[model samples]
Target: MELTSGIRDFALTPDELSGFHARGYYGPFKVYEVDEMRRAWRGERLRLMDREYAVYRSEAAESGNTNIANYDRHLDSAYLADHITQRRITDRVTSVLGPDVLCWRTEFFPKYPGDEGTDWHQADTFANASGTPQILWPDGAEEFGGTITVWTAFTEANEETGCLQFIPGTHQSMFYDETKRMHYDPSSINRKEKDGVRRGFFGYDYRQLQKDPDWTPDESQAVSMVMRPGEAVMFWSTLMHASLPHAGNVPEARMGFAARYVPTSVRVYPDTEEIEEYGGRVSLERHGSVLVSGEEKYSHNRLVDRTTRGHRFVSN
Candidate 1:
């Protein structure tokens, strides 16, 4: 079903487009009304607990703490399937990624009260955790290689609730090498501090992938993104970004749904059958990229139109 009555376009203006290129990120723009988002989330949250159609079906896929469990709920849930193709998101995403785009992956980022902030990091091949390039761009695509991430705030995201932070213009160069290995220790979560801020990268230390072990992120240059429910931000995955620790001042958890997009020409999870991360491993048996915009002319990656539940995905 269509999200609304008429055609809605949320494409970025020329100035906004240029600003994103300059800063490596764009807007906490409106995607849904506050009350609408809250209501939708209330039902969707319960529905998500029944993940019978989810792509990953390993033992760890049922664990609340493992990141693998949160991967690609869009592939199963009707609400999320519509969200990825929502014009509010896809219009702006295509403004940056061009006409033909594929939503390769999506993941949920939740921070409960007293939860540690995410470590400052950037993803190029997204191999920081798994030690394998998840997405491989074409040989001549060196000018831009990382995926465009559209992170939607499902709940209040503020300083107290661990909102995201970004260092402007840092997407052009990667300070961390995805080829380097990172050790995963779930116990290390919320147990360490970087520059006096409580932080960790899920179960691994993102610093382990840093090209310069001696170099540290300059916190002074970072800016926090405070957003209300239903707002969304788009940025290059290679941008230097992280979140603050939830201070426990508020009872509500900060929930972020991140949908990752790349041009159809790029190979999604090249030659990978399974992903091992966050202390768990899962098969990619049912994984396929959703073409969110335009026609797919490439056959290098798998593509799916309808979700596992027979709900057709909205494509523009």
Candidate 2:
């Protein structure tokens, strides 16, 4: 499949949709030319430093774990705000999630040279890290409750640079239970291993919450998502996925921007006001999920029409 100008011509064909449901993931589809993505990041990185309108509290934004600190820029940055609504990303996301969708979260996954690979895991309520049910689907939709994640590579992602890897068709059943508790120790960041691989879940070991301590994810079916800058992959948040350790000798880091989408029927951050996790805490006073497509008929969550910079969030 060839790349098209986003929004103008980028809906998935029937076969593409079928493949996505069967495999639980789809694409290293092109969103921007390698050079185009590289150029955009060069300038945007500087503007991102000013996060005055960022939704998270100062403590959360300054957490020792960079992933937590880099959460949800789409709520503040114009570039990211526009990004979550892109046709190439949103159209496909809506296809899986249905027309009325809300982008409840965005995160930056950055892996520096020699950093530990992400532990193989999946998320349902996203309570794995925070120990709080962040999203709740209605009873009828409970069977498929996880969010749809569109992860875009903002930099080169390869085996050596800690690219993503996935075990196909594993979205149907979960190996780990989010309700189980996992101790968060910031010192454990780069100092853990599972099944012999040097990996850790930011500050927690994912295996702590495994449904069966004796059961481990089979790594034999893993496929590396080596992508050029600007390419993206869409997957169920419950899919068995992990990443390689950044072993490259280069100083450049791998950056994957992930925007999470869910249907309007789902309640985001249900009965939660503060996110306490990863050895830190953040208040959600300023947090608001953006409507990326269709319309919102529910009043369960706060909605934002513009970014902190006064940039409008255009809904498709």
Candidate 3:
């Protein structure tokens, strides 16, 4: 859809498109009303507890489960299945990544009260903690590569509840090397502090992946992203981003659902049958990317027409 074609109501404006390219991030636009989100989440949260159709079936998939288990709930839940293809998200995403796009991955990022903030970092090949590239871009776009991540605030995401932070325009160049290895120790959760801020990358320290051992992110340049219950933000996965620690004065937690997208040309996961991360390992037996929009001309990875629990994916 060309910028002037008036293709979709939500199609980004020329200025917004250019701004996204310049900043590597987009708005916290409304995807659902606040009252509606509250009601939907109340029921959906309970429904998610029973994961009979969740893609990752390992015993590791638990409520507080961190890594692989937290990955791809959209592949099972009817609400999430329809959520991914919602035009409110897809229209803007398609404007950035042509019409032929694939929803390769989705995950839950939750920060309960007293939880540590995420360390400042960027992901290129997304191999920082996994020891293998999760998403591989085509050779042509190799130098400047990363997936488009649309993170929706499922619940209130504020500074006190651990809102997101980004160093604008830091997506083009990675500050951390993904090829570097970071050891995972389950005991490390909420036990470490970096530069005075309580933070941990799941079971591993994200600082271990930094390209410079002595260098630290200039925190003075950071900007916090406070979003409402139903708002969403689109950003490049490679952006220098992190989150504030949940200060813990309240009972409610911050829940952000991230949906990752890439052009069909990209390979989802090459030569990897299982993922080992966050102190657990899970097989990719039921893993498949959903084509949320346009045609899939490339057969580089597996594609599923609908969700496993019989939730039909909304294809645009």
Candidate 4:
């Protein structure tokens, strides 16, 4: 397959990088070709809306407010895989995490109108579930196990339609306690409630954390990330971010896709033999790792590859 330069020229500038470092995340960087992305979006939406493709809808309030509907290798149809693997994205990651990199996973998010927004949370707390070790950088270290998350907007992202919001600089901390999964309660406010602000599924109880002498929100500041169709924002895995609720009056839903990249050196699982979920303990090795980059190592275990088979794994 022929490869293009990807979106390097459109990469985040120095000021943009500074903002991201100071804040935790940044951008609306134009990644995919706009016209091409629009075509892909229209085709995918038609397939879903017309029942030509199967979609999994989240059970009410079980897995947070957001309902994620996905269609995979459809990315191949848009040549997204080739573009993503290009030097631009990979090189930038190398600059941060060093030479060895491999894409870990990818998924599409189709947020229907009136769909609930995701609660604010850091990605690292969930890293354990992926079988990847928690990465910590040593003092004065120039690089770490950099995981780049590329979130591409298949449609215009706006506050009215549940755009992403991020809390600046919240990623450089330790994992939030995962001893118990909190029940979803829309009315509950995080005790460190900045001016009574209502943010979604921040795993831990902020009220309790506020009392801990070492805990802080990590220089918190909330800002909505708006992007036009085809643009994307890439952020580190541990960044504190969440999406706003879709309040738009559009007839169709908002769609976005997130592709996660990680270096090959990171050991996926360290101590755990298996993880228990949905009344069963599943082996992470059996599921294997998701290939979002490199020489197209496809897997039936992944949502992207499964889409090619016309089957989806939905929780019973």
Candidate 2 displacement at residue 82 in angstroms: 0.9
> Cα lDDT of all candidates, in order?
0.88, 0.84, 0.84, 0.52
Each candidate's clash count: 0, 0, 0, 5
Backbone collision tally, model 4: 5
lDDT preference between candidates 3 and 4, better one = 3
| lDDT tens digits, residue span 1-316, model 2 | 0112234357778999999999999998998899989999999989988766666756656644445668878877888888888888988887788778888988889899989999999999999987789999999775797899999999999998999999999999989889889987779888877778778888888889989999978799999999999999999999999998888688999999999999888999999987777766778777778877777887787777745454343332
lDDT of 1 at 197: 91
Pairs clashing within candidate 3: none
lDDT of 2 at 89: 90
Sort by TM-score, best first: what order?
1, 3, 2, 4
- Model 2 regions lying over 4 Å from their true place: 1-8, 63-66, 310-316
The residue pairs that clash in candidate 4, if any, are 23-169, 119-200, 119-201, 120-200, 131-268
lDDT for model 3: 0.84
Give the per-residue lDDT of model 3 (tens digit) for 1-316. Answer: 1112235679799999999998999998999999999899999989988878887878776554657777988888889889998889989998998888888889989899999988787877777777899888888876658889999998999989999999998887877888889988879889988889898778887878877888888788888899999999999988889999999988998999999999888888888898778877788877888888778777677877644575333322
lDDT of 3 at 285: 79
Model 3 TM-score (2 dp): 0.94
- The residue ranges of model 3 lying beyond 4 angstroms of the native Cα positions read 1-6, 62-66, 310-316
Q: What are the TM-scores, per candidate, against the unseen true structure?
A: 0.95, 0.93, 0.94, 0.63
Candidate 4 TM-score, C-alpha based: 0.63
- Tens-digit lDDT string for candidate 4 (1-316): 1112234443456786677677666566766677878887777555544323322222421232332223233333335455455454555554444444445455667667766666555554233323234332333544443457778888888887788877767666634543334343334423223334433442233333222446545325777888888887778867767777676487667788776666544544445454432222433332233333333222222223322334323221
Query: Which lDDT value does model 1 have at 189?
Result: 84
Per-residue lDDT tens digits for candidate 1, residues 97-185, read 88888899999999999999998999988888888899999999889878999999999999989999999999988999889888888
Where does model 4 exceed 4 Å of error?
Answer: 1-19, 45-80, 86-88, 125-146, 183-220, 269-316
